[model samples]
Every structure is written in C-alpha cells, then in structure tokens.
Target chain A: MRPVLIMVGREFRDGLRNRRVVGTTLLMAALSLTLALLGSAPTGTVGTSALSVTVVSLSSLTIFLVPLIALLISYDAIAGEVDRGTMLLLLSYPVTRWQILTGKFIGHVCILTLATILGYGAAGVAVSFANGVAEQGAAASFAVMIGSSVLLGAAFIALGYVVSVLVLDPRTAGGIAIGLWLFFVVLYDMALLGLLIADQGKNITTGVLSVMLLANPADIYRLLNLTGFSNISTLSGMAGLSAQVMLSGTALVGALVAWIVVPLSAAGLIFARRQM
Target chain B: MTSPSVRLVGVSKHYGTLHAVAGLDLELHQAERVALVGHNGAGKSTLIKLMLGVIRPTEGHVEVLGVDPAHHAFAAVRMSMGFLPENVVFPPSMTGAEVLSFYARLKRQPVSRNRALLERVGIAAAASRPVRTYSKGMRQRLGLAQALIGEPRVLLLDEPTTGLDPASRQSFYEIVAEFGQKGTTVLLSSHVLAEIEHQADRVVMLDHGRKVADGTLSDLRRLSGFPTCIRIGLPSGVRFHPELPAGMAECRDLDERTMEIRCSDASKLDVLRYLLDAAVPLADIEIAPPSLDDIYVDILRRMAAE
Candidate 1:
C-alpha cells in the first residue's frame, strides 16, 4: 500500500508537470460553458428550464467529449512508459506491477474527475445565473448529471487502460483508443439504430434493446442522469425509450460501475502477465 | 566469510523456444565487482534481470541476498539492490529533483537524502530543471543518482557508462569505487572489454546464453594459454640478435637493434634470464602479458569450437 501511494504521488506529479491536468480542466470548462450558454436559451418556458436543459446538452456533450478526453489522457498509460524506456526502470523498484497500474489509474482518474467537476461546475453556476435562480429539485438533478458524467469518464478511463496494457506499442494503442472512441460515441448509436430498423419491429425486442444499450457506458450514463427525473427526461428526448426500457435507477448505476471495474481488472491482469 | 550477495544455481530462462539464459550457476560475493562481457544475445541482460527479480527463471533457483527472486519477501532484498539498465529514460516532464524524489519515495528512502545524491552525481544545479532539458550524459547521471538511492548493497549496472564522457566516466568509477569500498557488490555488463578490464575485480564471459569463462584477470590469462612476448632492444648501432634459448618461441629481430621472444606462461622468466645471461647488447627489455581482451576472445573461440 505504501508503494502504491508513492507511485500514485509520482504519477500525479507527472500529470501536473505535463500540464495535462490544467489543459484538460480548461478544455472541459470551456466546452461546458459553451453548452450551458447555448443550452439555457429556452429556460423560463412551460417545458424545461436551466438545470434540466443543461443536463440534456451536457450529457450529449459528454458522450462525445468525456470518453475522448479520457482516452486521450490514458491510452498511453502503460504502452507509453514502455516506449519511452521508463517501464523497466520503474519496475526495478520494490513495487509490484499491480501497484504501478493501480497508481496510474488513481492518478489519471483524479485528473479526469477534477476536469469534470470544475468544468461542469463552472457551466452549472453560469447556467443557474443566466436563468435567474434555479428551480426546486433542479439542483439535485444537476448534481446527479455531474456525478454520472464522472462515472462515464472513469469507465472510459478503464477501457483505455485495457487498450494500453494489451497493445504492445503506444502508437497502436493510440490508434485503437481513437477507434474505440469512434465506435462508442459516433458509430455505435448509428449501428444500433440500423439494427433496430433492419429488425422491422420483429426480432429486436425492447428487452434486447435495453441490454444492448446498457452495454455501452455512455448509454448507461445517459440513462442514469437523463431518465429518473421528469424535467430531465422530457427535455433529454429519451422519455419514450426510458418508458420502454423499464430499469430502476440502481441497476443503471450498477452497470456503469461494472464497466469501470471489469476493464480495469482485465488491464491489471494483462499487465501482470506481460514480459515487461 | 560473508554469504554471497547473489547466487544462481542451475538457473535458466527460456522465452518460448529461444533460450535467453541456459542452465548456469554463478555467485557474487560482497564487495566483488564482476564485469559481464558478451555479444548482443549472450544473456547478460537477462541474467541481471533474473537476479533483480524483474523476471522469474524457468528452471532451477536464483537467490539474491538470501531470498529466492520469485518470493514475495524479495522486496526486502530489492531495497538493498540498485539497477541501472542499458537504456534508462526518466519521465521528461519531471524536474531532476522530482525524478530523484519519485524514485527515492518508491525506493522507500528518506527524501532529504536525494539532494545529496544529486550533488554526488554532479547534477545538483539541474535538480530544479525538468529532465527534458538534460543531455544524454546528464540523464545518465540522474539515473546513477537514482540507483545510488539508499546506497544499495548490490548494484547491477548494464552498460552504465555508455553516454558518459571520459571525465564523467572516471568520476562514475570513483563513485562506484567508493561504494565498492563500502561493500557494494557491483556487476556491470559492457561490450567494450578494455574499459572495464582494470575496473572489475573479476570478469565473466558469456557466449550464447552460457558462461564460457569466469576468473580474475591473471587467472584468465593463465587459463587462456596465450603466450607472453618479451621484446629486447639492443643498443644503438649494435645489431647482434643473440638469443640461444631452445624452448622459447619466435625469437627474431624486427628492426636494426631489437629482438622479440614469445614464451609460454610458465617459461616467461626462464627466457628473460637466458637473454640476460647471454648479455645480448640490450638497450631495454619489455614483457607484454596477455590482456583481458585476448583471454575473452580465446574463451569465445573455445566456446564456439565446442
């Protein structure tokens, strides 16, 4: 445990010196501010207001941006060290391989979480100010959005670790990480929609669809923040599908938690089995 | 006598079909500096890694500081061990001090000592600067400082002085010598046989995953069976080559006033006495013994012949 903590401290220092923490924080903040400014234009209406509308836009932005950012930061966690010729030296220390992996995981997750909270928090404050005081229960739903978005970022962080450990080279791991981002963010929804259309409402049951959507961490994140509350689901545009899917709030959160743990465990195992 | 710092008993490691290290047995005592010389694929690096417990051997046993390398308790051994790999790159964004502190923390050493280590390795001024701004030799010095953390009892250095200039290399050896005097068992691998010939207390020659030779410099010279040459220079304008020794070989004149005689290891003094007894109008006599390079080549030749 001491070794792990030492490694975590080192990794965190490395992140700060590299300016990854600051750069990512700034980027998340800027994008979220833009989404909030544009997303809050329809507040004070009969339908949705600042908090719920911001949640909708922020969730959409997260699907595109959070995983991409997480992958960008974490895809080289192991492979990059090996390429730069530091892995062997680091391994020569008394610490075990699992400690190094866990340390790096903790450090990178800290960076991403910092970026998520501060970035989204700034936008949340800005949106609340623009709407002339937030409504009742809206602040609670907004908190849930920020929290679930962090989970989304963590799930992708673990997935990036899987890519980093399994791939032999940093360049290959980087390419595969981008491919993963495209598959999950852009191509996955299109492919699922295609599968639904081709089914012609015959073979693709609602149960199958729910399972399929839950398989993607981004979708699970969306379900967690966008569906449970009324104002969020109405503006999130997932009310019809949410009614059909039929999942409690706990089950959706559990699925996202599994996404973070399972891939992280696999990465640790692969790193342990590896030669370097 | 103190127990060996490192001991390998019939140890071998194979990666799939390729034998990285064949069945081998070797031991390194405390304060003993051994140079591991070999070709590119001769298993020197693998052997170092095996002793460091970075990789487990497939067959037989490896005992480093009295603990099997594969054991969980070997971390205690590692605390007293330092390693500088052939290519060691510190994280670029970290300051030199930060890098040393990072390694110091991981090594479980007192962080306050890191500043002195940086000063010891002559990188103190650059301690506050990021490592990316460092040159190759400076980076290597930083690597040495990290390895010196906790003053490891057993140091495994693979081509450590590769990028160091001559002066830096000399200081590096001085530091290593200081550590050696304090009872650090140092094993460094290098392809340049001449550089470490005088530095190492003993030399171990490896050939294609096998230990072909291991001994002190004089022991190796005696074992290699290479002849030592005695060159005698006659006085100016005196060209009489008068060497009447039957057993001595290659007694011939090279220039107007010089004669050379080659003799076996056992008969070097005998030939010298015969030349002196003959009173061969000599100017000066020089005896050239077999060098470590010659013994190493001879050992490799013998290994290949088998």
Candidate 2:
C-alpha cells in the first residue's frame, strides 16, 4: 500500500511536469467558458436562468470533449512505457504490476477530475454571476453536472487502459482510443437516433431505449445531467428522454461506475498474464 | 554451508520452438563474482531473467537466497536484489536525479542518499539535467546507480559496460568490486571475455543454451587440454630455428628472434629441460596458456563436434 501511494505521488508529479494536468484543465475551461457565454439566448420571458442554459450546453460539450481528453492522456500509459524501454526499468524496482496500474489510474483520474470540475465550475460561476441568478437548486445542478462529467472521463480512462494493456504498439493503442471516442461519443448516439427514427414509436420502446442509453457512457452522462433537474431538462430540450426512460440517480451513477470498474479489471487481468 | 545467492537446477526456457535456455544447472556463491559468457541467443539474458523471476523456467527450479523465484513470495526476496538490463531507459522528461530518486523511493531507500549514489556512478554533474540531454555513457552510468540503489545483496547486470568509456568502465568495476568485498553477489553477462577476465572470479560459458564450461581460469585451462605455447627467443647470431625438444609437438619461427614451441601439459617440464640440455642460448622464454576467448571458442567447437 505504501508503494502504491508512493507510485501515485510519482505519477501525479509526472503528470504535472509533463503539463498534462495544466494543459487539459486549461483547454476544458476555455471551451466551457466559451460555451457558457454564447449558450444563452435572449427571449422575452425566461423559463430558466442562464445557469441552466449553460448546463445544457456544457453537458453537450462534455460528451465531445471529456472522453477525448481522457483517452488522449491515458491511451499510451502502458504501451508508451514499454516502447521507450522505461517499463523494463520501472519493473526492475521492487514494485508490483498492479501497483503501477492502480497508481496511473488514480493519477489520470485526478487529472480528469481537475479538468472537469474546475474547468466547468469556474465557467459555470462566471455565467451565473453575470446572469445574477443565485438559487441553491442551480448550484446543486451545477455540482451534479461537474461530478457526472468526471465519472464519464473516468469511464473512458479505464477503457483507455484496456486498450493500452491489450495492444503492444503505441500507435495501435492511439488508433483504438480515437476509434472508441468516435463510436461512443459521436456514432453510437447517431446510430441510436437513426434507429429511433426508423422505428417510429411501436418497436423501439422506452425500456429498450433506456437499456441502449445505458450502454454508452456519454448517453449516461446525458441522462444524468439533462433529466435529473427540471430546469436543466427544460433548457437542454432533452425533456422528452425523461418522459420515456426512467432511472433513479443512483442507477445512472452505478452505470458510470460500472463503465470504470469493468474495463479496468479486464486490463488488470491482461496485464498480470503478460510476460513483460 | 551458507546458501548460494543464486542457484538453478535443470532450468530451461523455450520460446515457441526456439529453445532460449536448455537444461542448465548452476550455483553462484555469495560474494563471488561470476561472468556469464555466451553469444547472442545463448540464454544469458534468459538465465538472468529466470534468476530475477521475471520469467519462469519450463523444466526446473530457480532459487534466490534459498527462496523459489517462481513463487509469489519471491517479491520480498527481490527487494534485496538488483538488475541492470542490457538496454535501459528512463522517462525523457525526468532529470537524472528525479529518475534515480524515483527508483530509490521504490526500493525503500532514502532519496537523499541518491546524490552520493549518482556521484558514485560519475553522473553527478549531470544529475539535474533531463535524461534526454544525457549521452549514452551517462545514461548507462545512471542505470548502474539505479541498480545499486538499496544496497541489494544480489546484483545481476547484463552488458553493463557496453556503452561506457574506458575511464567510466574502470570506475564501474571498482564500485562493483567494493560491493563484492562487502559480501554482495555480482553476476555480470558479457561476450567480451577480457573486460571481465580479471574482475570476475569464475567464468560460466554457455553454448546452445547449455553450460559448456564453468570454472576458474586455471581450472578451465587444465580441463580443455589445449596445448600451451612456449616461445623461446633465438640468441643473437642464431638465426636458424632451434632443434626440436623432447615432447614438443611443433616448432616454428615466430619472428626475427624467436621460435614458438607447443607441448602438452604433461610434457611442458620435459620441453623446458630439453631446451636447457641442448645448450640453446635464449634471450627470453615465456609459456602461454589458452586465453579465455580461445578456451571459449574451443569449448563451443568441442560441444558442436560432440
């Protein structure tokens, strides 16, 4: 346990030294602020304030942005080390394989957490202050958005590890990570929309829709953020999703947690059996 | 008797159909420096990995400090062991100090002690620079520093002197020799026999994944039965090659002033006495046994013939 923590500290420092933490955090924050300022429109009467509108836009932004950031940062975790021959040197020390894996996982998670929270949080605060809306419920909604976005990032980081340990070549791992981003973030939902459009209501039931939504982490993040709050749902225009598929907040969080745990455990098994 | 620092019994490693290591049996006693001499693909690295427990043997047992290396319990034993791989690398973003301290912390050693350890390897001047800026020899010395961390009882180095300059190699041997004096077991692998000839106490030669020869220098010279050369100088004005001595196999003019003679071990004395009886005025006389490299080549040839 001591070694594991020490490795985590080392990895954290490495992440900082390489500017992984600072780079990702700044990118996410800049994009979040851009979306927040432009996301709101001036209507005669406001159904919800600028804060909920920002939530709507930022949630959409996270789906495209967070997983890409997570995947980019973690896709080379194992394979890059092996290619550079550093993994051989690192292993020659008295450290265990699992410790190395867990430490990197934690370090990447910390980077993603910092990126999602501060990136979204600072932008969210600026928008609310400009809009002059300070209700407690809006704050809670903002917190949920930031928290679920981090979980989404963790899910992709875990998926990245699976690719990392399974592939021997770093370029192959990079190709796989990009492929995963396209499938989950862009193509899966687009395919689901196409299916729903073709079914025209009779065949594709809401329960089936719920299960399908559960399969993609981005959809889970969408479901958790857009529907969990009424003001957010009204502003994001995903209010229709809540009408058909019903899931408790706990279920949404559980699904995202599963996305993180299952793939990471698979990586652990593969890494343990590997010779290097 | 105290347990040998490293031991192997009938160990073999087969990669697909290629046998990396055939049945090999060896034991390295504590504080004894052994050089593993073999050509590429001759299982020198595989044998080192087996002793380190990174790869399990297909046929037999590998033990370190009396504990089975293949078992999970060897992790504790590994804390006391060190390894310097043939081609080592560190994270390019890390400075030399950062890299050594990273390994030091992992070994449960005091990170502050790395300053001196880095200096010991002759890399202290560049300790604060990123590893990417280092020269090849500097990186190799840094590798030595990391392997020497925690004062491990068993040290396994593979081609440790490959990229070192002469002066750095000199310091490297001196450092490991001091460790050897303090009861640390050092097993270094290399094909250049002369580099380790004077440093290693015993030489273990491998051919086709098996131990073809293992012994001290004198022991191997006697066992191989390779004839020793006795070169007697021609006295001034004596230009023709001298007459043959009893038990001398062949005599030939080696140079302008010397004749070279070869004799079996049992007849070297008789050959010397015959030269004396012949009233052969000699400028210089020297007996030369087979070099380690020659013995290595001879052993491999003998194994192939058998």
Candidate 3:
C-alpha cells in the first residue's frame, strides 16, 4: 500500500510537471465552452433549443472527449517507464509489480476524475447559464454525466494500461491504444449500424444491443446518458429493445459496473506476469 | 564469523536456448568488498539480477541474507540491499529530492534518512532540480544515493563510476570505504581491473559465464605465476660475475649499466646480498610487481589457451 501510494504520488507529480493534466483540462474546457455557445445559437437542427442544445453538447463532449483524453493520459503508463529506464529503479525498491501497476492505475484514475469533473463541470455551468435552466436539473445532469464519464474513462484507461504492458515500446503502446479507441469510439458504431442495416426489420432486440453494449463500454455510457434526456429516450428505444431494457433498473447499473471491473482486473493480471 | 551476506549454490539461468548463467557458486561474506570482473558476455549482470531477485535462476538456489530471493521474503532482503545498474535514468519530471523520497517510501522507510545519504554521495545541492536537468555524473550520483537508501546491508554496484570525474570517483570510493567500515558487503562489477583492485578486498574473475578465478589479488597473481620484474640500474664501469638466486630465473643486462631480473619470490632479500658481494655498481633500482592488470591479462590468455 505504501509503495502504491509512493507510485501514485510520483505519477501525480509527473502529470502536473509534464503539463499533460493541465493541458488536457484546459483543452476540454475550451471545447465544452465552444459547444455550449454554439448550442445557444438557435441552430437549424431538429428542435435544438437552448436547453436541448446545452444537454446535447454536454453529452457529446462526455461521449467523445472523455475517452480520448483518458487514453492519451494513460497509454504510456508502463512502456514509458521501461523506455526511460526508470522501471528498473522502481523495481529495485521493495515493491511488487502488482503494487506498481495498481498504484499507477489509481493515480491515473485520480487525475482523470479531477480533469473530467473540472472540465465537464465548467462546461455544465456554462451551458446552464446560457440556457437559463433551473439549477437543480442542471446539477443532476452534470452529476450523472461526470459520474458515468469517470466509469467510462476508467475502462479506457485500464485498456490503455493493458496495451502499455503488452507493448514494449512507448510509441507502439500509444499507437495501439489510440487505434483501439478509434475502433471502439468511431469504427464500432459504424459497424454496429451496418449490422442493423443488414439485419433490416429483423428481431434486433434488447439482447443484441445488450451484447453490443457489453462489447463496447463507451456505448453503454452514451446510451445511459442519452436515455436520461426525455428527447433521446424515444430514439434510444427505437435503436433496440436492449436500449429499452437497459434504460432504467439494476441491469443498466450492473452492466456499467461490469464495464469498470472486468477490463481492469484483466489488466492487473497481465501486469503481474509482465517481465518489466 | 558472521553468515555470508549472499550465497549462490550452483545457480544457473537460461533464456530460451541460451544459458546466460550456468552452474555458478559464490559466497559473499559480511563486509567483504568483492569485485566481479568479466568481459562483456561473461554473465556478471545476469548473476547480479538473480541475486536481486529480478529474475529467478532456472537451476539451483540463490539466497541473499539467508532468504531466497524468489520468495516473498525477498522484499525484506531488498530493503536492506542497494543496487546501481550499469545505466540508470530517473523520471524526468521528478526533482532529485522527490526521486529519493519516492524510493525511500518504497522501502517503507523515512525520507529524512536520505538527506545525509544525498550529501554523502555529493549531490545535495542539485536535489531540488529535476533529474532531467542533471548531467550524467550527477544522475549517477543520484543513483548512488538511492542505492544507499535504508542503509542496505549489501550494496550491488554495476560500474558505479562509469560517468564520474576523477574527483567524483575519489569521493565515491571514500563513501564506499565508509560503508565498508560500517560493515556493508559491496559487490561491484567492473572491467576496470586497476581501479577495482585498489578497492575490492577480493576479486572474482568470470569468463564465458563461468567463474575462472576468485580470490585475493595476490592469490590470483600467484595462481597466474606471472613473475614480478625488478630493474636495477648499476653505475658505469661496474662489472661482476653473473650468478643469481634459484627463484630469479631470467636475468638480462639491457644497457651498459642496467640489469633486469624476473623474480617469482618477490620477498627474497638475498638478491641484494648477491649484487653487493659481486661488487656490482648500483646506480638506481626499480622494483615492479605483477599488477592486477597483469594477473587479469594472464588469466584471460590462459583461458583462451585452454
């Protein structure tokens, strides 16, 4: 535990000194503010009013920017240490490899959580002020978005860790991690849409979407947040019965919880046996 | 008569088809400063890794402070052991103080103790600066300081003086000497035989992943049988009959006044008497014993011949 804390402290200090955490936070904040202002412009979309625009912008940022930032922050966690030769120095201490991996995971999660809350929180406030919505609903939406974003971001970060441990070179680790994100974030959605098109009017029910949700944790986060808004719940319903099944209740929360645990545990196991 | 600080019983390590270390046996007693001398592929680094529990031996056993490094107790042993690898690089973002503190915390010890260690190793002033800004020598010093964390009972140093200047090297040895005074067992690997010869109490020579020779410097010199050469310059116009001692096998007169004798028994004072009785004119005399370099070269050559 002490070793883990030491590693965490070192990692946190590194994150701050490298300006990666700050830079990422600032970038997200800028994007969130831009999205909020644009959403207020009385645009020509299908019913994109001030409130809907603000909510959609926050949700979009949570879906896209959160996982990308998490991957960027954590993809180099292990391979970077090995590349710089600091892994040897760290290993020479009286700590196990498991401790190191866990400590890094926790450290990265902390940084991600802070950045997510602050970046998305500032954006949430900006949108709420622009839309003139009641503070209560806006706060609730902000809480849900940040909370689910953390869960989604943690899954991606652990995935990055798995990539980092499996790859020997930092650049390779980063490349593989980014490639994985592109597959899940962008390509997976396109593939799923194609599968729906091919299945055309068939019974693409709740089970199929549930399985797809399990395959991509990011989709589950977006579905959960989208389901929260009254305007998108009907569209989410038509997407699949799995969307309706997961809209509210134990299954939805349970599936999201599984998203956080399974990948992280696998990463931990891989890290335990890794040579470096 | 304390137990050996480190013991390796027929330890061997294999990487796939290649045997990095094979059937090695060694014992490092408490406070013994032993130098591990070898060529590049002699398995010196592999042996150190096994001792540190970084990698397990495929055959036989390795025990550091009587604990098997492959076991969980290896952490306890590691807490009391300091290691400096051949090439060391710390995290670029951490100041030297933070780096030391992080390691100190990893050892489950205090950072306060590392302050004196940093000063002793001669990197106190730069402790506040990030390690990336440090020169190679300063970085090496930081490594040395971290190695000394928790006052390790055994110090494993691999080419600890590689990037050090002459003054830094001298100061580094002084710190090592101090550690030895406090009963720290120091095991160092180096290709610089002369420098190690002055510091190590005993030398272990490795060639081709095997222990070729291990003993005191004098023991190795004796085992190699490379005789010490003594040159004596005599005054001009001094002539004497040439009858030398038995152990002094080869004697040659190089110039009009100088004679050189290769003597196996370096302590033989009778050679002086012979020269005195012969009425030889002695201008000046220079005695040169078989150095560690000579012993090392002789060992390598003998191995190659074998």
Top-TM-score structure, candidate number: 1
Error of 3 at B215 (Å): 0.7
Task: Give the Cα lDDT of each candidate.
Answer: 0.87, 0.86, 0.80
**Candidate 3 error regions (>4 Å):** A43-52, A135-138, A201-205, A232-253, B231-286
lDDT of 3 by residue, A22-133 (tens): 9878987888778778766764455534544556567777777778888887888888888887776677778988888888888888888888778867877776666565
Give per-residue CA lDDT, model 2, range A1-276, as digits (tens): 877887778778888888888888898889989988887556226757777778888889898999999999888999998888777667766677888899899988987897677888889878877878644577888889889898999999999999999995799999999999999999999999999899899888878999999999999999999999987887677888787789999999999999999999999889877776
Q: What is the interface RMSD of each candidate, in Å?
A: 1.1, 1.6, 1.4
Candidate 3 lands at a TM-score of: 0.90
Inter-residue clash pairs, candidate 1: none
What DockQ results for candidate 2?
0.56
Considering lDDT, which of the candidate structures 1 and 2 is the better prediction for this target? Answer: 1
Per-model B-chain TM-score: 0.93, 0.92, 0.91
Ordered list by lDDT, greatest first: 1, 2, 3
Model 1 CAPRI rating: medium
Q: On residues B39-71, what C-alpha lDDT tens digit does candidate 3 reach at each position?
A: 787898888888888778989999999999878
| Model 1 Cα lDDT, one tens digit per residue, B1-306 | 999999999989999999999999999999999999987889999999898888889898999899997889988888889999888898888899988888888888999999899999999999999899999989989988989999999999999988789899889888888898899999999888878878899999888788888899888888988889888888888866554556667677788777788888889887777777887677898888877777788877876787
TM-scores for all predictions? 0.94, 0.92, 0.90
What's the fnat for candidate 2, on a 0 to 1 scale? 0.60
